[model samples]
Target: MASPRELTTPATLTEESVRRYREDGFVHVPRLLSPEEVSVYRAAAESILERDMEVWAGGDDGAAVEVNYTTQVWRKDETLRRLALHPALTGIAGRLAGVPLRLYSSEVLVKEPEGAPPTLLHDDEAGLPMDGLEQTLTAWIALVDVPVERGCLSYIPGSHLRADSERLRHMTSFEQFREPDEVWPDFPWRPRVTVPLRAGDVAFHHCRTLHWAGGNETDARRVGHGVIYMDAGTTYLPGVMDEYLAHMEPGQPLDDAELFPIVTS
Candidate 1:
């Protein structure tokens, strides 16, 4: 495995990079992780899938055959956690958010070859009902090389600054909210860029950026992981409109513990 130093570099996002992000609402950081690191993560993912295949296959009776999100893979899987909180990625997120960042959530989204549905199109903030324009950032890391034809990500640049419209619809996954005509009426709704990524490349997007991913038509699998980061001062809105500050545990603040445990006052 590559040393942590290779993966974690303390560099500021360039002016052009920041400008492009503000203009397009997203930026792609190519080769963020070494091939060795990528391989480690890939092996970890496969191990997880193997252990959970019974559950994935809908274990025992027919009752277990339902498709559900699995948090266990992340909680127990060391490699996933390591990659999720990689310093280089979090440092960039911290810079973007303008506050100390915390791991909001970690998830692995795998689209199997053929027959899988596209993820709904919507902003990340749509899931959390909070007023004001405070932004949350998401780092999407590809575990395997992905081509445009094999379900790479598509985005509408600079759409994050726009107000949330009725065009935004609620769905179980991010891909369902896509209605290109409703979101972009002027131009022919073609993506300016199709992010074809090598393994370990990361794409960072603002919370409100408009993006979507299509179904995988290839015979191979398309797997990616997402790690969301929120600025330090950001409050977690539990239940309804009530805001609760995060309380951190000693050195564990930098690492994932629970949801913002320490609310710095």
Candidate 2:
């Protein structure tokens, strides 16, 4: 196992990967975590999920097959918090963002055996209550082998590069209200790419990238840890998420030492 300092000192990323992330709006890093580390996270995530947590199933009709998830596990578990601020992870995010980054939030998402439904296509920025939406992205670490049969993630390539337009705006709004099982054949978003990851692999996607995951068709469980990172200067948008971020005023930086630790400086 590599020491934390070693992991932080030299990030495991290539210039080509960075360029590909910029062009495609996402990048995959194989074996970002060691087998032992994968075991640790799997245990931690499972323990956290075992406790009472929120369950979100897409639209109104999807509640029957809700996906179980818990956010900000870093607040409760030291190991997860360390993973959230891991140097290698932060280094990848900072290099991709071209700026220093800070922790926005961390979540563990799970799909039960034959119980989870397909996730709707949506951009993270539409749901996040932050001003610097463009500067945000998520590092999704697979704790278990996520094959297509197990509902791996899929994304619209280069979707992040599209300028804000009426069509994009409408599509974002429509997605928010669409049912979990609904699929628009002529929805216009195209050239989608599905990514299957083995345990210990990580996928990084821009917040604006349109992405979704399939249903858990296999009998095994599918679990993923997603750590959202954003520019250090990103500010809170008061009305959107007043309950969770009321401590900070509108336009104020999300720099709480304990809540939003600076990952890259």
Candidate 3:
């Protein structure tokens, strides 16, 4: 590997890119990150994943289901936090969402080599367990080369328009969420490109965009770092909320500087 390059803030989001994201509910930003930077953070992500595995293994009755996971890891890893707060990506997220932003969560997804389970097609807002929400977005950064066969993300075009697909919102449980084809029978499948990523590319999608990943059959693992951002000034609605944020009390404002600090360039 070559020496790491000087890490700086990300470039401004282009008008066409923003337009594409608004129209499609998802946009692929090519090479938003440098290979050197991805390499550095890839190791960081893997370390946190391996560390979690060890913890699970060390516990009593350590044997768990054979599955794919590595969620909410940034809480413990500094390197992950760095990537989550990187200005380049956050700048685009803020612009796309048309609001200041704060991190909702940072998760690491690992699709292990050979027959790794595919991610369920679902919307991020559905599982929030809250009602009346701000426009949130997710930045999915590819840490390694991810082809379609390796479980790259597939999204439904224009799925963000509430008027276009509102009835499907009630199906929020990711466990019960099915592939996009069955969601809205009236809209029909639109002929469009799927969102895949290179090692350093970042794909930003609206929180409610219909998306899914296929099973990974490759020998190489496909791993990605994902950051979800909520519109600034958004609050937690414990009344309709669920277990995801059980730690925090109900009705707490989400723009907590110490916890979900704003990511500004």
Candidate 4:
């Protein structure tokens, strides 16, 4: 088990654990940080909720929402910035990506109590418009205790290695990600697995993994941080990309230090 203060320090990832990521496309790393250490991160999250955050909102303006998924929280405060650049994540990303990784973005995905809407099955890569779509993933760390009842994620094992990945790659929208297993009847995947984690436990997942979280059935809120990691030197794809890319140059590579600095090299 990791001590509270050792939260920022990198853990020695075992070969077997790395192999799990290679094969399954997702692995839950235990004791990534202690609950005491996670308090600071929780504070950061609370601070974010306290203000008018420039959150993506996941289509909900405020009321009658599915989940209060917010983005760019790292841009607002110091604790969030530290969590985004934490060396522990980069160390793991270096091993997983087999190349230096950069911070793509940091977000808070919160599911409020009283049956918050479930997250429909979807992959992070298809939603992102990067040309090197496969060169990215999300490092998720639960900010609070997350059981299946509290909106934890469930992933279809080995779906990232599917043959019809291209078809699964660029979905027009999350609503459009109807069960791919049905579309490609031959899609190779085992039954989905629901991830359960306490505060500070982490899960690393490939960008293309078909995953979803159930509605929050518990009385408390479910919250976690997703720090985006992209392999260095990925570029923007113009026409097929999301609306956010309208500001950047069409052919520009996303290697900007100020925005997407190298987390590991």
**Winning model by TM-score:** 4
TM-scores vs. true structure, each candidate: 0.72, 0.86, 0.82, 0.87
By lDDT: ranked, best first: 2, 4, 3, 1
How many angstroms is residue 91 displaced in model 1 relative to the true structure, after the best TM-score fit? 1.3
Pairs in steric clash, model 4: none
In terms of TM-score, how similar is model 2 to the real structure? Answer: 0.86
Expressed as tens digits, the lDDT of each residue in 1-265 for candidate 3 is 2234433234444688888888889988877788888999999988888877422121226332223446666677888888998878888787788777778788887777887656666677766644445578899999998898887888877777756355354433435544555656644645545667889888888887877777788899888988888876666665322566677765667766867788752
- lDDT for each candidate structure: 0.63, 0.77, 0.72, 0.77
Across 1-265, the per-residue lDDT of candidate 1 in tens digits comes to 4344454343745667666876788888777788898889888876776665322442345431222233434456888888877777776666555555656666666767764555556567655433232557888888898777567787877777665553342343434445656665642544556678778888888877777777677787777777776655454332221232234332232333464322111
* Candidate 2 wrong stretches, greater than 4 Å: 1-10, 61-63, 166-189, 239-242
What local lDDT score does residue 242 receive in model 2, on the 0 to 100 scale? Answer: 42
CA error at residue 133 for candidate 2, angstroms: 2.6
Lowest summed lDDT across 10 adjacent residues in model 4 is found at 2-11
Q: How far out, in Å, is residue 263 in model 4?
A: 0.5
Off by over 4 Å in 3: 1-12, 53-67, 130-132, 168-183, 238-244, 247-250
For model 2, residues 32-121, the per-residue Cα lDDT tens digits are 777888899899888888884677744476364536789888787888887887777777888888877888889888888875788767
